[model samples]
Target chain A: MSYRSIKLIKYPTQEFTPDVFDITTQAIPTPKEGEFLAKLSHLSLDPAMRGWMSPDTESYIPPVTLGDVMRASGIGEVVESKNENFPVGTRVMGLMGLTEYAISSGQGINPIPKELPAEAILSVVALPGVTAYQGLFEVLKPEAGQTIAITAAAGSVGSLVGQMAKNLGLTVVGVAGSQEKCQWLTEELGFDQALNYKDADFAEQLKSVTPNGIDLFFENTGGAAQAPIFERMNAHGRIAVCGLIADYQTDSPAPGPSWLNIIKKRLTIQGFTMPDHIHRFPEYAQALGGMLAKGKLKYRSHVIKGLESATTGLDLLFEGKNTGKLIVEL
Target chain B: MSYRSIKLIKYPTQEFTPDVFDITTQAIPTPKEGEFLAKLSHLSLDPAMRGWMSPDTESYIPPVTLGDVMRASGIGEVVESKNENFPVGTRVMGLMGLTEYAISSGQGINPIPKELPAEAILSVVALPGVTAYQGLFEVLKPEAGQTIAITAAAGSVGSLVGQMAKNLGLTVVGVAGSQEKCQWLTEELGFDQALNYKDADFAEQLKSVTPNGIDLFFENTGGAAQAPIFERMNAHGRIAVCGLIADYQTDSPAPGPSWLNIIKKRLTIQGFTMPDHIHRFPEYAQALGGMLAKGKLKYRSHVIKGLESATTGLDLLFEGKNTGKLIVEL
Candidate 1:
């Protein structure tokens, strides 16, 4: 039998182009002595993938090498196994790459429960959930009654972040790219206020919404909304910079707000990536799963059909076209 | 008997022009009940004065109200006293303002040892010393063998910070505005390397000096050198934003480096003012004093003559003209 896999052909100079990746057919290989071979059911498309495609070796994780399967996290079911831990029919998830089939020794892979749907697993129990949990609880350390402003607020990670903050009694203000996302944040997710960054009077609206000023900032997208939110930060504010999706595609990212406000307000700005805190994934996933089961968290997936769609679908995240978590279902 | 006092008559719109201050003659008042009359001998001129001269109430401390004695820290002798804790002839240091005489209830005052010269006391045991100690040890949390890049390396606070870091076995790179200051940092303060920020190849020099990349950044001056130093920071770098002398005078401060590097390197940048940590002053002062007594700390004072010189002498700090700790002798 034959399965298809996409391989990165070249590193992007600025932004990803279709030519950067090439899909190839491969015959399914049998598992080795201690390995398990699985057929991937779903693939996750995240903003962090942009960093992985670049040639920057200094990043949290090494960039995806050319001529290799494009790196991704996915849900798969074990079809063939030489290992007892991941026997036949066992569902697993990890950085299995963008492929219909994968072989693993269970090094970084985790056997997931069979009950949850693939969309829920990829959206809330995967990278997005764990990242939101870590950034909101650990980095921002939100307090009840504290106002938090999260950028990309309707996206996978950000939506989870806003929901978690709201559940903890924080006044959550979400910043997104479109009015529909903003309405979803406020109406569906119960975010206190949601502002569209594209509005001409966005800064004025931000100031009006956050009368007491922002105490915590969960920065996912570093763009136009950053300066306005930064200016409204109260004294002793803490900022958790989880992602810079807006700047990910450009070689010349915009300069950040002046550090004068940083000093004036005695702010703490910390940047973090999930790879650095990978060891805590299982622990974070459990907490997030509990939140999901208790109905304290709500997640949406912008599912794209087939493995080949992932190449072009990634731009949906960069362009803010995706309504929720960008996922590829094979 | 009368004393000369400089009062803030107007808030500076951008930079400090001489007209903002008024030299007023006042009768030296007798101590009432708990108050003590201090004959100010030496006034410390710091870069923080620029912030105090502004109308921005959002700053760390309340700006000096117009028509009040221009706020400053100084060393003085309690020539007349009503309080037992501050006996007559006792040497003291505190925020006594820009005056030849001050009356105090000894609220924030710290009685100092009569042995140390006013220069050494103000430079190493007062604001500069405690600020440097707090920023280096507490904020940056230096680990031995790590490299630290300190801006305004020849200034009072920066000089002590570099010296303390060097004593802790860290490789120190000092960034200054002048060749003379750079020479002092390397030769006198024992920094591993000192680069003049004005040099055309300053960034290249910084990169060469910090071959392993900067691990800790002591950001004092937010100017042309900031971007270069920020760009060279290594993974998990910690930046302590103590002062921004370069931006204090300008109404429009330059934008800081892109947040992209913050994520790529997982850097933690914190802004702090000494006022917030004032409760720990005595503890920090004692440690810094011990370092000074053991000859582990070296400081030089650029003493200007008379209280009247303070209004103009204050500009030396903003202009980066002061060779050492700027002090006004009465």
Candidate 2:
């Protein structure tokens, strides 16, 4: 049988827009020893995919080179398997992605429930969920009664951060790119306040909402938005920077506010990668999963129709078209 | 009895230059019910004083008012006092002032031993000394066998940070302004290596010394010293921002070299004020005083002659002239 795979056949040198990918059909490979073939149901499209296209090297994984099927995370049903650990009809999710069918050699992939929906194995219930959970409680560690203002608060991780902050009794404020997203942040996600960063009076609105000062800031999109908030930070404030999508796709250097304010406020600004806290996975899945099960957690996703639209789904994130996690269902 | 005391004038806005401060002697009042009086002996001339001169806004404390005597930490003798908690002739070191005398309302001052030379009390035995101790061990928390780099290596806090990091079994690299300071850091202060940041290839030399990347960094000077070190930080590296003296006196905006790299490296950069860790002072003083008394730790100081010369001492710190602590002996 033949399966189609979308690969980044050309190296993107400049801006990471469309027309940089190549999709083709190839015969599905047969499983060897310790291998399994899975039928993909869902795949995650993330802004980090742009970083993969860049020439920067990573420690554990090889850079995604030209003519290679782009790497991604997805969940699928095992149709055939020779490996005893992963039997046929079992389900798994991990870095096995961007295709209708895949043969896994088992580096990082792990088997899960065959009955679980693909959405659970994908965006909000997957890495984005865990990223927000660990980054909020573990990395930022805002105390109860403190105020937290976050960018992209309508997006997956940011939305979860707002909800979790509210649950943990923190005063939550959100900054979104549009009015609708801001509305969603305040009215639906239960954030104490929301600011539309695209508005001209956005800075003023941010000040009005957090007059006492921001005790904790969860930075997802970093750029111009970081300036005014830097000035109004309280003494000993903390900033947890998980993503800087505002400058991710652009090649030009992004200008930032003065570093003096960071020192003046005696801030603790930290950058964290989620898997680094993989040691706390069971705790997170247990705690956040319990929150999810209790209906205390709320998450949303903008899912594109098919694997062919995965690339477009990612671009929407850069344009701020998608409010939450953007996923592609095949 | 006639005693002259200086009070906190209005908050200072300009640099600690000549026109920035005014001196007036007022009759010192007798200690009331819970009050005490101390005759100032030696005053700490610190880079942190520059930050205290910000606009009449909130900081770690209210900005020293315009007409109030300049706020400072000093080792002084209780010349006359009524409070039983602090009797006559006892030497106490605490946040006193630039004035010759201070009358406390039993606020934050603690009376001490008359034996500690005024210079030693103001130098390595007091706030600056305890600052380096707590900042390096408590905030930066360097691990044994790891590499640590400290900026302003010859200054008060930097000198002590180098020694404390060294005592913690870290390979300490200190960056100072002058050749003499560099030599002193390595030869006298137990730093494994020292480099002059004024060198043209200073960044390259730093990279060579910290080949494994900086596991911990004591950031005392921000502007030029911190920019290059940002690129050389290891994953999960911790930076304790003790001070930022390089730009302390500058009115213009300083430079920033895309600290977004802070995220890719997964670093933790935290700025700390000593008073925030005041609860840990007794513990810190015990450890540091023991280290000093045992001859395991050593510190240096640049002394300026009288209260009138304190302005010149402040400029010496800005010019990076004095090695180790800069103090004004009255």
Candidate 3:
């Protein structure tokens, strides 16, 4: 069978667009000895992909080079296998890329549990859920009654962060781009309050919702939206720096919070990557899986059909168009 | 006896010049029952004074109100005493203000040991030394052989930070304004290397000295000086945010290091005040005092005579004119 794949043809100098990718067809080769071939189903489109597309600089990982298939996490069905671990007809999830088929040496691929939904493996069980669990519990250690304010509340990580914080007895206030997203956070996710950052009175709304000032701020958006929330942080507040989705498209990093307030308030801010939290995956999977099974956890995926739609589908994340985990079904 | 006192007549709007202070004469008042009087000797001048001078804001302590005596830490000889715990002729250290005499109810005063030099009480045994010790070991937590780059490396706190980190077996790089200050850091204080931030090739100089990348950054001077060192920080670096002396003179808080680098490097940045670390004072004093006694630690004081010099003496710190702790000898 032939498969369609997207390869990065050029390094984006300004902003990332579909023009950087070259869509082409190639023959799907059979798995060699000690290798397995998986038919890719759902490809995860994330904010960190912009960082991966950038030219090499000081980073946790090297930038994805040109002429390579766009790196992504995905779920697939093992159609052909020579490896004993991943037999034929087994479902798995790993760095399957934005492609129709993947041949792996079984280094990173993990078999998904039959009881869990296939999409949940990509959304909650795999990357976003693991990230939310670690960042909330380890990085931003909020007390039981402390208030937590998270940005990108309608997104995969933020939604989970809100629900988990609430489950742990902490008050949660979510900040999102639209009223619909805000309503979903407050009404469905049980967030104490949700503020639309696009609203004229966002700063005031943020203050009204978090009357005692925010004890923990889960910073996903890093720009103008961050400035006001930073100003309202309580003394000795903790900030878990997860993503800077706002500055990904910009040439340089956007200006951060006022250092004066940071000094005056004695705030502790830490930036973390999810890869470092892999050791806690079993711990997270057991907890997050139990929550999901008990109906205490809820997740949503904004799915787009076809491999050709990968380019435009990613832009939806940058524009905050997707309401949850952005996925491209190939 | 008549004594001259510096009082804040008006709140400083922008840059702090001599005009905000009113140097006036007042008779040395007698101490009431349960109160003791001390003849103020040496007073500490700090960059944090600028923050204290600001109108009411969120802070660890309340802003120094107008019409109040300019608040400062000072060494004094107890001339009159009603409180038996503090006998007359006892040399004490406390918030004695910018005055020739201080009347205290023994709230904040601490008696200084005769074995310790009076200047040492104000420099290493007091605020600056305690700040450096805690920020280096407790907050930053740099392991031996790790590279540490500090801003304001010639100032009271920075000078001590460089020395302490070196004593702990960490490689030290100091950042100062002039070549002389940089020389003092590397030669006198035993810093591994010192970079003059004012040099034309400061960025290159920083990169050359911190060949393996900075593991701990003792951030003292904020603004332009900090931006370059931040880029040179290694992954999983720690920043002990001690002071933003560079931003004190400005109307607004200066922008800090790039949030991108913070996320990319997974930096742990924390702002700390000495008051918060007061409980650790006993621990710091024992360790730092031992180092000072064994001739392992040395300190300097830039003493200006009279309360009249308080205004210009403070400017020296802002301009990086002082080689060490800026003190006023009354």
Candidate 4:
């Protein structure tokens, strides 16, 4: 039998185009000693994928080399196995790429629990949950009664972050692209306030909502909302820069606010990525699973059909079209 | 007897001109119970004074109230005292203002050693020295072999920071505005490399000097050199934002570099001011005094004569005309 996989043929100039990837069919190979062959059930399309496709090698993780199967994280069930740890019918997850079948030597793959649905595993117990947990707790170090402002509030990572902060008794203010996303943050996730960045008087609205000024800022989208929130930061405020989704598609990203405020407010801004803390994944996953079981965390998946839809589906994240976690199902 | 004093009659529009001050003669008042009288000797004119004169009350310290004595730090001798800790003939230093005499209740005053010259006290063991110590050891937390790039490298605080870092076995690069200042950094202060920001190929020079990429950045001036130095930071770099002297005088400060690099490099940028760390002054002062005694620290004073020169001498700092620590000698 043959399997289909998408390969990145060319690096993008400014933004990703459909021509950058090529789909091909190859014969399914058997697993070697200590290896397993698994059929991917779901693929995750994340914002970090843009950095992986770029030519910049200085990023937290090395970019996916040209003409290689595009890098992605996914869930799959072991169909054939030579390794004792990962037997047939075991559900596993890791950086398994955007393909129907993957042969793993059991290096980075982890066997997941069987009871959880594929969407729950990919959304909560995977990259988004771990990233949110690390950025909010470790980087920002939120304290109860402290106010926190998070951008891209409707995105998978941001949604988890706002919920966690809210659970900890923080005054959470969320910034998103649309009114619907704003509503979801305030109505469903229990965020204190949600502001749409597209509004004409967004800065004034932000001022009105955050009367005491922001204390912690979880920056995911670096765009129009950044300056207003930064201006309102109190003394000794901390900022955790997790992503710059707004600038990913453009060659010329906008300049940041003046450093004068940095000195005036005595602020601390730190940038982080999940790859640097990969060893803590299992610990974070366990904590996240408990939260999910306790009904303290809520997650949604924007599922697309088939592996072939993965290439075009990524733009939904960049364009802010996807309502929640962008997932491709085979 | 009457004493000459300078008062802040008006706040500047964008830059400090001579017209902002009002020279006045006041009767040297007697000390009340528990108060001591201070006869000022040498006054220190620092870049932080600009923030004190501005209308921004959100700064690290409150702005100097209009029509009040202009705030400044100076060394003085106690001529009369009702307080036992600071008796007559005691040498003390604190925020004594722009005057020849001051009255103190010993709230912020500290007694200094009589053997040290006023220049050494103002240049190394006072505000400049403690600031450098806190920013280097407490904020940046430098390791032995790491590379550090400091802006305003020839200034009092920057000079002390470079010498201390060099003594700790770190490769130090200094950025200055003039060739003389650059030479002073490399030749006199023993900086590993000193680049004049005015050089047309300053960025190229910086890149060639810091081939290993900057691991620690002591940001003092946020001007032309900031973007280039920021771009060269290595992964997990730490930046201590101490001052932005370049932007202090201007109504429109330049926008900082894009924060995209902050994520790609996982950089940490923190802003700090001495007022926030007042309680640690004694500990830092003792450490700095030891460094000076061991010949591990060197400092210079650009002394201007008379109390009236204090108004214009401050301009030397903003205009980059002052060669060392700007001081006014009575």
Candidate 5:
């Protein structure tokens, strides 16, 4: 059998464009001993993908090498298996890359509940959901009455964070790019309020919504959007830095938030990546899974068609065009 | 009786000079219904003094009001007491300001063991020592055999942090401004290694000394000194930001450490103030006080004579001229 795959042609110096990658055809080789063959069905476009494309050596995960298949997360069905853990017809989720077929060595790939829809597996039961769970409960540790503020409020992680925080009785304020996203955040996600970051009166709106001051800030987008909200932080506030989508496009240093306020407010800022917390995945899947099973939790995804639209799907993530999880239905 | 006092005539916009304050004579005020008369002896000069003098409204403690007595920490003898908590001849420590005498409401004032010397009380058993203790043990939570890097290694808090971390079986690397300070950190304080930030090969030296990578960074000086060490931080490193003397002189935003590294290394950076942790003071006083009594810990002080020398003494702190705790002897 043969399959098509997106390969990284060159690393982006500033921002990633479609020209940096190209589609190539390859023969689907047999699985090695203790390995499985996964035919990808869905691909997740995450903000961290931009960081992985950087040529810099500072990232936790090494940069995706040129001429290699672009790395990504996806859900797929096993076509063949030499491993007892993953038999043929098993549904799995992992770093399956932007490819139609993947030969997994049983390292990162994990079998998931086939009953759940592909969208649910990729959104709430996969990387984004686990990230929100760990970053909120373990890192940020918000109390019930505390006010929580987040950027990219309508994105996969930010939307889940607001809903989870609301479930715990915390006041939630969301910042998004457009008025429609803001309305969705408040109406669908039950956020206390949502403000459009592009509006000239964004800071004023944030001030009015968070009259008690922000106790926890879930920072998904950095740069100008984050700096103003940081000034509204309360004493002993906690900031969980999940991603920096705003600054991921550029190689040059981004403007920083005031360090003096960190001292003045006695803030605790922690930066986390979910890959490091794979041990707690089952716990996350159980908690976030149960909420999704009920009507208590909800998620949305902007699904693009085919492996050919992978780069465009990622572009949708950067432009804030997609209201929820940006995905490619292969 | 008459006593001399230093009043804040003008707040410093840049570096503080002698003209910002003036020493004036006033009659010793009598104790009120619940107040006590404290005859101040050794006034502590700290790096946080720069923050208190900032005209900006962002600080843990409110900025010292213009024409008011400059706020400070001091070791004093209670000459008269109208409250039962404090009695005549009690050796107490509190915010006694830069004054020959002060009338205390007995709120912050605490009586110390009469046997402990003024230098020990001011240096290792007071605000600076408790700060180092809480930051290292509580916030950073360094494990044994971990490599810890500290800036301002010869100053009051940094010096104690080195000694405490060394005692806890961590390899301590200190960064200071001068060779003499480095020598004091390594030879006297038993630091594993010390590097002069002024050295042209400062970063290279840091790389060599901390070959295992830094696990805990006690950040005393921010800006240029911190940026290099941040590059050498190990995965999941903890940074206890005790102070930022490097950026305290100016209100305009300073160049910050790389946020990308914070995410890449999965760092936990917490900014803390000792005043907020008063509940833990007795615990610190007990642990550190016992260490001081047993000769397990040591401290030094640069004492300047008279209330008139208060401004110059603070200048010594900013210049890095004082080898240890800078204090004004009145």
Candidate 6:
């Protein structure tokens, strides 16, 4: 058994400062029927987690409870198992709570390969990867020669969505919070162009970037930054809404554009929860992994060292600090 | 030919006062190959006609040019035809440009039954009826026990939409401008509830009418009226925008509510032009006519006596003066 167990003892309410999270020692418990215990390896820290702590206003998902171990999906080794389905040494990933030691009842857990390195398992073929792959390829259905726009172009899901659309021959433009992220999106990710949303002329930049107008929009951030941009979308545009990272930090609710223009343009905007696509996870992962293996797609992970720094990783996401996927390694 | 041949004509614009229309004689011409010519018998006067007069906007259909013998769809008889596909004396409904004698190149025309009364062809089974049918039945797809809220609920399209939704087992609630129209919708049209938008507590009335939150919104009006109603839509609700009569009356542009709430509720809003569904016209007419003949469906036509009253009919539509379908009989 793993001697050391790290647990997120409390859920954060406001902006995730260092004091908001507490990591405490825990005794690894025995597994009950249909249950298996996992030693956490790669913990995913996403902007969506901020939404999970907000008051259960209206969302496709529920918020994490108080005094409970914070919820997360991560890849780790099954050190102890009471279920025959997942025996010892079965490396798996799914909704394992944020802790070094986790006892999952096999509720949503699935086996990961031992061949792949632990951290890469959380990168190339993880939930974030599937989100990008499915939302772009399956939902948005962008055509070649069409223009596509995505917010947070250098982040995990947005980067992959833009790159996938690019690989399919679409003209890709990215919007990012900083110039460095914009540069990386254009130069490194092969995006046709990138706009620094932090600039005062961010919305105006959209008109110039997509002169003919965006045929597809992969909505990542949903606030003032994303609202004005909707007017630049072409007729019959399809938008696959993955997350609204911008509103996650706000105490007030984010309002949408009047959308009279959206109606006239015949835009289709659909919000999806990734858990709804779990059945096709393996299919999405394999296809994207093949692209990754062939050096076609790449993603960066801003990794924090230990469980004690988990809040730092989450804080970085809220502050728009990181340029890519934020992960915590314990 | 029968002696009656009353025709509609236009005067000038830049003002809404009289002298906007003038009548003149036009030659009767024969239909060429693949075309049919129908003698104008009845013209459908609708609220959408107001939007069609503007020369600048790129609407679903092109605006009628000023000084043209105003464009309209009407029931007509094939008095003379050169085309073999359509024989002489065959009954037809065509875009005859609001003339008693029209040469239709079959751009937008449908054949009406010889047996059905001429007035029936201009009322139900026409643009207004099929628009309500296709939009509510096809696009919205509401289920039994669900609530449907229709604005302009006493207008031709809205009245039919609420009744059809009711036939499909939805609890239909209507919103009209006047107490009389609201009473007509509730008592005469069998809508479960009706609210006068002019009521001091209009928003509260909307809440009371659709206590479960509206599942489908048949949006016939878009303006100051639509803003508050959107807040009463349930999660995953659908809004089918057929006409925006409210904005067409104003010389200035219209603005609607900002769209942020659509995401939180995961709602879908779509705008459509009915002729886009020309392929389903025959089917739509059959179902609508069957419902009408069986007394399962009721329709009212606020018919102006002569083509000279077309201007009055149109003005009446903008003023919400008519209860149901507005038409001018020659």
Q: Per-prediction TM-score, chain A only?
A: 0.99, 0.95, 0.97, 0.99, 0.98, 0.93
True contacts kept of each: 0.84, 0.52, 0.87, 0.84, 0.53, 0.27
Considering lDDT, where higher is better, how would the candidates rank from best to worst?
4, 1, 5, 3, 2, 6
Question: Ranking under TM-score, best-scoring first?
Answer: 4, 1, 3, 5, 2, 6
lDDT of 6 by residue, A1-330 (tens): 434433444545545565645566666789988898888888888766776675665655776666667778888889888899899999888877678888888877888778876556676688778988877877688789999888878888888888888899999998888888988988888999999887887878778777797888888887656765777777778877777777665555455654445445666666666766689988988997788888788778788888767766777887789867888888
Q: Interface RMSD, all models, one decimal each? A: 0.6, 2.4, 1.1, 0.6, 1.7, 3.3
How far out, in Å, is residue A125 in model 3?
A: 1.6
- Residue A284, candidate 4: C-alpha displacement in angstroms: 0.6
Shift of residue A241 alpha carbon in model 5, Å: 0.8
What interface-residue Cα RMSD does candidate 5 give after superposition? 1.7
Off by over 4 Å in 2: A58-62, A114-116, B1-14, B255-259
* Model 4 lDDT per residue over B39-85, tens place: 99999999999999998878888999999999999999999999999
User: What are the lDDT figures for the candidates, one per model?
Assistant: 0.94, 0.78, 0.87, 0.94, 0.88, 0.75
**Tens-place lDDT digits, model 1, residues A218-258:** 99999999999999999999999999998999999999999
Of 5 and 6, the candidate ranking higher by DockQ = 5
Q: How do the residues B125-168 of candidate 1 rate in per-residue lDDT, one tens digit apiece?
A: 99999899889988899999999999999999999999999999
lDDT for each residue of candidate 2 in A30-107, tens digit (9 for 90 to 100): 899889999988888876677677767632134687787888888887888888888888777887868889888766
Model 3: per-residue Cα lDDT over B47-144, one tens digit each: 88887888856787888788889999998988898999899988888787888888999887888787887778778988888899989888999789
- DockQ, per model, reads 0.88, 0.50, 0.81, 0.90, 0.59, 0.34
Clashes within 3 Å, all models in order: 0, 18, 0, 0, 0, 9
Q: Alpha carbon lDDT of residue A250, candidate 1?
A: 91
State TM-scores per candidate: 0.99, 0.95, 0.97, 0.99, 0.95, 0.87
lDDT of 6 by residue, B103-217 (tens): 7665566666888766566667888888888888887888998998888888888888888888888999888999889888888889999888887888887876676787778
Q: Could you report the Cα RMSD, in angstroms, for every candidate shown?
A: 1.0, 2.2, 1.6, 0.8, 2.0, 3.9
Full ranking by DockQ: 4, 1, 3, 5, 2, 6
Candidate 5: residue A222 lDDT (0-100): 84
* Candidate 5 per-residue C-alpha lDDT over B1-330 given as tens digits, one digit per residue, 9 for 90 to 100: 899888988988887787999888999999998999999889999998888888767577789999889999998999998977888998889888989899998888888888987888889999889999999999999789999999998889999999999998999999999999889888888999999998999999999988889999998888667878988999899998888887777667586664777788899989999989999899999999999988878888888888888878788877778888888888
What lDDT tens digits, residue by residue, belong to model 2 across residues B1-330?
554434444444445555666667567677777778788888888887777776636667666676767778888788777788788887787778787888886567876776656666666768878888877877887789988888888888888888877787999998888898888888777789999888999999988888788888888888777877877788888988777777677676675556567677788888778877788888887777788888877777778878888755678877887866788888
